[model samples]
Structures are given as C-alpha cells and as structure tokens.
Target chain A: MQVTVTTRTRSSSIAGYAAIALIVIGLALPAFASRSLIQDLFFILTMLTLAQLWNLIAGYGGMVSVGQQAFVGIGAYAMFAGVILWGMDPVPAILLGGVAGFLLAIPMAFFAFRLQGAYFAIGTWVIAEVTRLIIAQWKTLGGGTGTSLPREATSDIMGVEAIAQLFGLRDAAARDVLAYWLALLLAVGTMAAIYALLRSRTGLALAAVRDNDNAAQSVGVDARRVKWMVFLAAATMTGLVGALIYVQTARISPDAAFSVTTWTAYVIFIAVIGGIGRLEGPILGVLVFWGLQTAFSDYGSWYLLALGLIAIAVMLLAPRGLWGLIADRWGIALFPVQRRLILEGTRHG
Target chain B: MIWLDTVVQGVLLGGLYALFAAGLSLVFGIMRLVNLAHGDLIVASAFLILIVVETLGLNPFLAALVAAPALFALGWALQRFVLNRVLGKDILPPLLVTFGLSVALQNGMLELFSADSQRIAAGPLESASIDLGIVTVGTMPLLTFASAVLVIFLLNRLFYSTALGRAFRATSDDAVTASLMGINPKSVFAIATGLAMVIVTIAALYLGMRANFDPSVGPARLIYAFEAVIIGGLGSLWGTLIGGAIIGVAQTVGAQLNPEWQILAGHLAFLVVLILRPRGLFPRAVD
Candidate 1:
C-alpha cells in the first residue's frame, strides 16, 4: 500500500510535467521550428500515433491486426465528406472522421471479432478492403480516380512556401511544414493516451489478456470486451491519423487512404523492432526506421526488401525488440506499468 | 434475362475467387499464419508465367504449369528457411514478418520488373467465349471458374480422404501432438505453404490470362482472397466459393445498375455479410 501510494504520487508528478512540456512545445512548434523540420516531425508524429495505437492492440491486447488501414481510410473519407460536402472546419471534421471510423468499426469488429488470433487479423484486412470498395464505388468521391480535398481547404496553414525558403526547400515547404507539425502532435497524443491506458486498470486487464486469455477470464476480466474496447480505440485513433494524412496531402483516394503499405509494412516493422508489448519501443523504432529510410531510401524499391530483411533479422535475433533488450538488460522502464506488490515470507505469515 | 446472365456469370466468377482463397484457407486452417504475401505471391507467379510465355512463346496455360512447380519450391524454401523461425505462441512476429516480406517482395519485383503492367497474351483463348442458352460467357472466365471449383473439389477430397490431409489437419489441431506422433511439424508447415503456393500458381494463371498485372497488384489480390476466405468461413473451401460468388455478384450487379457501383457493391456485400454473419458463411477452423 505504501509503495502504491509512492508510485501514484510519482506518476501524477510525471504526468503533470509531461503535460506542461507538451503544451509548451505544442504552442512553440509552429513558431520555433522551421517548416521543413515541422513537416518531418509531423510525419513522424503520424507514424507514432499509428504505432502506439497498433502497439495497444497487438502489444497489450494481443490482437496483431494487419488491418489498421481500414480505420485510417474510414476516417479520411469521413473527413472528406464533412469538409467537401458539409463545409465543416478541418479540425472538427477530423474529429468527426474519428467518430465515423468508430461507427464503421462497430460493424467491422462484429465480423472480425468472431474469430480469434489470425482470423481476427485477416478479418481486419478484409474489413478495410470492404470499406475501400464501398468508398471507391461511390462515384462522387472520384471512384477509381480517388478524391482530393477541395483546393480552398488545403491550398495553402500551409505557410511552407515562406518557411521553406528559410530552410532552402524551394517548393516542398508548405507541404513539409503542415504535414510535419500535424504528425508530431497526433503522435504525442497517441503515445500519451496509450501510456495512460497502460497505467490504468484497463491497461492491466489488456496486459492480462495478452499474457493469457484464459487466465485473464478466470480473474473476472472480460477478455473479449477488453479486446473489443481496445480494438475500437485503436481504430478510432488510427482513423483520425488517416484524416490528418490526407488533409496534409490534400488527397483521399481509396487506394491512398486504404493503402496497407503505409501502416502495415513499417508500423509493424517499427513496433516489432522497438519491441512489441513495450512502451517507448515504437518511439525508438520510429527513430530508427526513419533513419534507415533516410539513409537507404535511395535504394528505391530494394529499400522495402532491405527493410523486410532487417525486420526478419530483428524478429529472430531480438524478438524482445531493441527496447525490450535494453530494458531486459538493464531493468529499466521509462513508462513502467507493472505494480510493485510486496510479498512476505510464508513462514512469517 | 440479362439479370440471369449476370447471376450466372457471377457464379462462374465465384469459382475464380474460391481459387484465390483456397490456399489462404488451407494455410490458416493448418496454422493461423495470415500470409500477407499470399496475394503478392500470386502476382509474382503471374509475372513468372508471363516471362515464361513471352520469352518461350509458349501458351500461357502451359507456362503456368512450368511456374507451379517452381513456386511450390519457392514456397517450400521460404517456409523451411524464413517462416518456420517465426511461427510462435505470439502471433505478431509472423504477421509482421510476413508484412515485411510482402513489402520486400513488392519492391523487389518492382526493381526487377519495373512498374509496367503486363498481361499473359493468350491468343484466340483470350477472345474465346461460349454462348450458353441465356447469355454468352467468356471462355477464359468460365475456365477460371471451373478451375476454381475443380481445385476446391480436389482439395476437399484430399483433406478428407488422403493421408496428407490427415497430416495437415493433425498438425493444425495440435502441432505438439503431431510432433509426438513423429510428424515433423516444420515439414508439415513447409509442405502446407508449398501447397498453397501451388494453388497460388493456379490463381496466377487466370489472373495473368484475364487482365494486365504489375508488381503492385498483389496486395489488392490479397484483399480479394482475404475477403473471400472470411466470407466463406476461415477453413471451409466450399464456403470460400460462396463468399467469392457473393463478392462477384455484388460487383457485377452493382455495376449493372450503375457503372460506378461495381466497387461499392462488392464492399457493401462484404460489410453486410460481416454485420449479419460475423462468423462468416462457413467457419471450420477455430482460434
């Protein structure tokens, strides 16, 4: 009980400091950071959000979904409708896009959740494709051509041209700035939410479920419910990221919105390499991944092949992930969720 | 009458969908590894066949035969070397590994083949059609549908009647137990993946024969196969046929109603089925 009290106090203090830091940084990012840096950060933030959300489901909840792109697409299209059709402001519309994803997920989860394990993973992909086809068929959205945001909505928050000149990015400036900052905030928010969830009782339940579903169920944990809840949460958050992605690019083609390659390929790679089921792994992973992309992206298509090889090597050599290895090696936990329960000797008891 | 034609064509088209899904179902049924590379492998096979046909001036169908054995070997090697290491109590490793592999394969193919779309030119067979009493059906599609049915039919026989099926099912049921019986679980998995590759080769035959394909087409094919597998039920071969038919009918009929409705129609059908029967049309495998 004493330990619990100490931990709680410590956690609250950390949360407080983190919140303050974030608020300060959030406000300052637009002003302090160059547009190019902001843009790069935004893209990283988007990946962070996705990795965190995926980490929650696959890492904590034991659902290794390959279909997070489904929610991403749903969110994008919803935003498209809100902005292009209803003329809603992009920010609020983006939130609504998340709700739209949530709604879509309700029906999606029903189909996917029926099967456990691999079926669940495949079910999510199938669901995403279904959404894609449905969206693609809706002709007004540009059909196979895919839809782009109306020019007014995105053509230019895009102070990149002005900012890019500062950093020597002649043309890609506005794009770099808008995309970068947006990605950064979203990623931070996702990580914060996931960290919070892991610390909460619900997070414990999810971890329990991941460790052993039967055991979790025996302990009065509704394993299925936890899975569903997290699934929905992950979907909603990911879908929202999808919105920000297209908003930055000013495009929402079914192919782009539902592109599995974007998330499934590298998000999984990042999380796996950073370490699955471990907090801070994805952060490390995203850093490493982007670093590799920057260094090796010139390999063009072979870059994917190399990434695949690296991921496989990492999975075999370090299944615990890079962060997992660090933690295991040093007994460190940056975002530790485990409780410190004290036990007395049986004889003393 | 036109609607009748559409319905018939959809049923026939369902056969192709079934073939696309059969190997996927087989792999999942045995070991719950959702091969993200499954569809891409099909595209890879098509490319292989295209190369063979284009270079050798052989019939596309004949080239498929040559490619099948090679794909099976490729699948065998991949499983024996790469995949076997990843199968585990933890599912994410395999999924991620495969996801990475899928990306690698796509980009690898792109680098080697470039992004230009290629079709396996089939000469007169490409244009051939059979006039049924109600409507005319393309000979190639009808053949594709028939091949799908035939593949499923044979697979069903193998699963129920053959010793190999027993090995596959037993391994799927309890890999540890199967090992105790002296069955090499790893070999079983390798064979299963190889067998799936063979099925993929068949799917490739039609995919190449029917339309133009590029390196990027694999993931989309994977989606179709995945949907069919789920809609049909995870492990049921025949159910995959029905699932494919549902998707096919929805797409064609939706297109019939409004040319723009084709894609939407397919997605709506999948969504509707998912909502109504989340367990799918036939669920033979369990988590």
Candidate 2:
C-alpha cells in the first residue's frame, strides 16, 4: 500500500488555470478599457489588496486589529514626505511608505500586544489616533490641512512617462493606467504570498497558535513570534497599499489619509462579507462591496447604513460569509489549503 | 493658582468620563461582551433627549428622565434580540456585530439629524458658577460630578446587596452553573443591558448639556470610555472612576502645554498605564 498527502484538489487546478487567464486579461485591460474603467479597477484592486492583508492578520493570525489606519496613514504620509521633503520620485516614495509602516508596526505591536482580545482592538485604535494627532503637527507637509503632490512631480512620475510613450496616451490617462497596473500586481502578489504562507509549515503552526495558544506553545510553536510576524507583515503590506492609493490620488490630508471609516471599517466589511480565513474570500468580498458601493453610494449616509445592516445580517446569519455559504453547499475548494491523505491500494480492500 | 484650577477642572471633567464608562463597566462585568457601539448608544440617547426637550418643551433633565425608559427598552430588545444571539466563546462575532451596529447607528443618526453640531439648552445653569475660596467651579460641573458619584454609589450598593446582583455575579462567573441554579443568563444579560442604558441616558443628559455633539463624535467618546475602563481595570467600578480622573488630568495638562496634545496626552497616559500594568490599576477578574 502506498499513501501520500496532498493539498491540491481538482477545483484548485481549475482555479489555477482561471487565475492565469485573469492575470493575462488584467495586464491587457488598459488597451481596450476606458479611463473610468481603469480608475474603478484601480479602486477594486487596491481595496482587494487591503482586504487580503487584513484577512491574513485578523482571520489567520487571530489578531483582530481595528487600527490598521495607523499603518495606512503613516505609509501615505511617509510617501508624501519623501516626495515633498526629500524630492524623491513618488514610485520610490511608495517603498518609503512600506518601510514606515514596518517601522511603526514595531512599537505598535509592543504596545498593542500587551492587551488581550477586545481590549487589543481599542488599544490599536488609540495608537492610530495618537499617530494621526502627531502627524497633524508636522508643519512641513502642510500640517493638518494636508498637501497635494506637486503637479510637476505627479506629471513627471517615472512610470507615467514610459506608459505615455508606450500606450500613446495623455499623462493623466497614463498615470491611471500605471496605477491600475501596480494595483493589479499588488493584489496578485498579496494573494500569492498569503496562499504560499498558508500552505507552509509555519501556516500550520499559525493555525495551531490561533486555535489554542497554550497547546501550540507546548508543541514548540512560538505563539508570540508568529503573531508578531503576522502583525508586522500585515502592517507593511497595508502601508504599501496606502502609499499606492495616495500616489494615485495625488492628495494627502490627515483626516482623509487616516480615516478609520475608509481604511479600517470598509476593509473589515469586505473581509467579513466575502469570507474571512480563506484566500478566495476577499476576492468575492471586494466584488460584492464594490457593487454595493456603486449602487448605494449616491444616497450618502443611507448607503453606509445599509452596508452596516448587511454586514450585521451576514455575521448573524452566515458567520462564515457569502463564500462560506457557497463553499459549504457545493463542496468547492478553489484555493484549497487543507491537506488530504490518499491511499492507493488499501482504500476499499 | 492656575495649576490648582486646572486640576480642579480635570477632576470635574473626570466625572463626565466616569459616567460615560460606568454603563460599559457594568455590562462588561456581568457579561464579557464589549459593545463597540456603546458610545454611539450614548450619542443616540443624547439625541433622544434633544428631541424630547425640543418637542415637549421640557427641561433637559426631564427629557432625560423621559428618554431613560425608552432607552432601557431599546437596550433590552437589542441585547435580547441581537447581542444575545452572538455571545459565545468566539469573540469575533460579537465584536464584528457591534462594530456594524456602531456604523449603522452613526449613519442612521446622520441621516436623521444632519451633520450640524447640537447642544442642549440648560437655561442660565449653563453659565452658573460656584466659588470655594481656593478655586471657582461651574455649577453644571459640580452637578455632573455629584451625579457620577451618586450613580456609582447606587451601582456598588446594588452589586453588593441585591439578588439580581448575585445573579449577575453567578452568570458572570459560570453561566452554565448559574442556569442550573434557575437564573436565566440571557434574561440577566437583557436586564443588565437595560440597566446600563438607563445609565447611558444619564450620561447623555450631562453630555448634551456640557458640550456640542454630532453623529461623528461617538467613536472618540468610545475611545475615552474604553481608556477609562482599561485604566481602572476590567470589572472594577471605582477603578473606572480613577481611570477617568487620570485621563482627565492628562488631557487638561496636555492642553495647558499645547492644545493639540490634549487628546494625545490622554492616549499616551493610557498606553503608559498599559505598559506599567497590563491588567489595569485594579483588576478584579482573573481573566
């Protein structure tokens, strides 16, 4: 008899092929898609990236942070400081944002880790508030009022010039295209990274730690280290995404950049509505969220109210979210992370 | 003299924060649930008082009295119907649900009452002051502090003396065992939430009279209340009051140094407390 363990499933194989095709289409989308379409896609892709990173921490790491805005705002602010203060290109400045996020996560983790459960959520929020308040005091970057990326800097951005020549487009359209592409890369990269992490040995240890800290520690899993790694990684990626978002907008204000509603609340909604703890969940969630936003955003407060109600209903009725419902009903595993053992000879004999 | 006045004002300010945190402490003590929408509920109660005062031409205090029963009923139904269903070992559902409720309540209030900031009119009492030779204090602040003390005293009395208090302790300690002893944990939770809402109404009364409030102010209020609860230690009422005073003093001092550091100072103080004593100043619960 021969037995082997496999994480692959038939659905995953199909999903792999579908993902390749989607990537190909995404890369070529700028050729035929309208400017508005590109911008909308940019929004979707960046949001998807944020959702994926958030799911990695809250869903997999068992650290539900409500202060992700701290990273986002810091990243965005760092990028702006790079451009306005150091006269660096916005593209490289985005990396500065990621580094800022990573640096901020160190102290943030130190403080927030002291708290447990729901208190941890509030602690993170307090830190984010402190960050915003301090950032508002930065007089060089227009202080609390915020500043726009210089017109020359934005128009003469690195990729914008290359895209302008290659696509025969105006600077504005080219910038949008460039942002859309970066967002696509980011979204794909984040998903791939998370998927690979979940399939690794560390992933199993992470799940163990999340399920039972003492049990995992008894088995040699460094629970705190794993949590620290997850928190730092999420913060870094969230910062990168935040930088990319602001680079696209070319505007940075303390309130708008550090908005809890836009950065944290909306991201939480996307993760929760799609299906947390699964790689495919955020993809499904971002689409539903985009659709709802498009449909109801014009109604202003009513739109937010509806979203809240829907999220609550999903939590109570389907704790697993929309994808959870679909996966359970169909036994689907589009991105299967679960391992299965197969016996060759002794199956039914 | 100036420093003394600042300290006096901070102590008075602590009274309001204690009121904001008292109901939260009560509910958390009874059930491990932390309602993220707590601040929003306080804001909603304030709005309710505003409506009663406007429509019926009643004083803000009387309006709060009228709104208290309604808030109690709302809280009872909210816990019985919504929050009770989500309470269990997994903390994710309750947190997410309350977060959603917070968002919903904020937006609902926004839709109903525009974005304009509103304040409750308290006639001449708003500006009335008292002189104690050392430092003068506003009459409203004095009244608010007295109310906070009275509420905490009554709550401590009830918690220590009543059968319902025993039931709260029993459910909090072991819900399954308490159920076996003929105390319905769910009903206890509902009554507890209702009682907390009544306190929220009182907090709302003072909140409206003290400052201007808008729909968007709830989250900040929540952070303050949360900091107070954490500073005081979980499941300890007197600890919450002291926590509130600590934050209040920090804010006043910060503001005196630089107005921008007011809120930042409160947060920093909370962080310092957390660093020094992660379990809080007077932690009552083992967990």
**Top model number, DockQ:** 2
Best by TM-score: 2
Instruction: List, for all models, the DockQ compared with the true complex.
Output: 0.60, 0.83
Model 1 chain A worst lDDT window (10 residues): A1-10
- Tens digit of lDDT per residue, candidate 2, span B182-273? 99999999999999999999999999999999999998888898899889998889999899889998999899999989999989999999
Q: Per-residue lDDT of A1-349 in model 1, one digit per residue for the tens?
A: 2222112335445756886787678756665666656766777778877888888888888887778888888888888888888877665677876898789889877777776677677667767776776787777778767877876765443355676665555444545555666676677677778888888888889899899989999999998888889988888888889888877777768888888888676888888888888777898888888888778877786766887878888888898889888887876666777666543332210
- Give the TM-score comparing model 2 with the true structure, all chains together: 0.98
Scored against the true structure, residue B90 in model 2 reaches a CA lDDT of 76
Candidate 2 contains a number of clashing pairs equal to: 1
Q: For each model in turn, which proportion of the native inter-chain contacts is also found?
A: 0.81, 0.78
Candidate 2: residue B92 lDDT (0-100): 85
- lDDT (0 to 1) per candidate: 0.81, 0.91
